[model samples]
Target: MNGTRLRPATFKYIESELYAYPDYQREINKIRDEIINGQEEQDENIGAGKNSYRKPGRPTERTVTRLDDNKRMNHLKEMVHVVEQVYDRLDDTQKKMIQLRYWSKRGANWEYIAEECFISRRTAFNYRKEIVGAIASKLGMN
Candidate 1:
């Protein structure tokens, strides 16, 4: 395992983000629901608004442009999308290595994690470097 070429801050940020995958999905779902519900309410009130004049121009902006206009939503989607793309490229054991090393609250030592994964401790560390390097590359931080 060659040392990661990522800067220290970038490496740490990507390492921390491994723990945020679940939270990101939940937030995405919540924001998605909010957008859907808000749109539905707007649809329900469309004809009853005080402004009686129907606009002669475009009824709605393109969905892509409208989504891009939302800074928070766009930021979250970009973060999640980059990580997921990198994660999906890993093999199953590599994913398991990540789960044991980062996501496990048990704070298991490398020895224990390696034992569980049937790999050496050095291999476990190598897997971590690879994972972090992949994430950094995907984010254009490397």
Candidate 2:
């Protein structure tokens, strides 16, 4: 009760976030390969005159930016899987709360979760604590 610690809940959220993005990870590797190849080709043509440069083509600024964006998207995707796994064993209410807090676009908070479930904020907090503890125990990280 000291300083309102929610270490377990925070940990569960983080773990779930990590598990959510398997597809993103796979896509990331492919993007990385494209980026690397682009860079290599760019280097090869740097001093080979405009015509040679035209053949392999330089790595465009847009390509670099797109690759970076794809990487970030992949990271977010992975986090979604991690969150799903962490909340999988929770009760329906607890699962909904976690999904709202971590997955939903509106960025739901304890107050929102409480309102949606017709419970007090304190009750919502307790539910989060219980669900997180379960997650930690299941993952052998308790």
Candidate 3:
């Protein structure tokens, strides 16, 4: 039995997506229209031969692989969107800290984050933890 648990009653699906706001609406459109629209176009006949690549007579292993890839991509895109939403929700400093600590190519060290945030390394580390925890909670992974 673990004492550390996320707070209760955080589900808010019906609410508007912060990622779909006017500022980032294009990103949402890309995900919804491109990925899902193509998914619908290809997924119409999953069991039949006419699928994915539109090959005839029993969709082959490649078609199945394509479908699986589409599904995985869709899920990954959704996860990215959710994380983007959480990123938007975080405070400005928190956002900067998170980006510096994670989104950077080499992944900035805590000292860098501390300097950027004008705080101690320990505080910077705590901010990163808090920001990441919020994202994980929003994605329903925590």
Per-model TM values vs. the true structure = 0.71, 0.43, 0.51
lDDT of each: 0.72, 0.60, 0.55
Lowest summed lDDT over 10 consecutive residues: which window, candidate 2?
14-23
Off by over 4 Å in 3: 1-69
Order of models, best lDDT first = 1, 2, 3
Note the residue pairs that clash in candidate 3: none
Q: Which ten residues in a row have the lowest lDDT in candidate 3?
A: 11-20
Which one wins by lDDT: 2 or 3? 2
| 74-120: candidate 1 lDDT, tens digit per residue | 76788789877877888888877777867765466889888888999
Give candidate 1 misplaced runs (Cα > 4 Å).
Answer: 1-4, 39-66, 104-106
lDDT of 3 by residue, 90-118 (tens): 87787777656555423467787789888
Cα lDDT for residue 86, candidate 2: 62
Please report the candidate that would top TM-score against the real structure.
Answer: 1
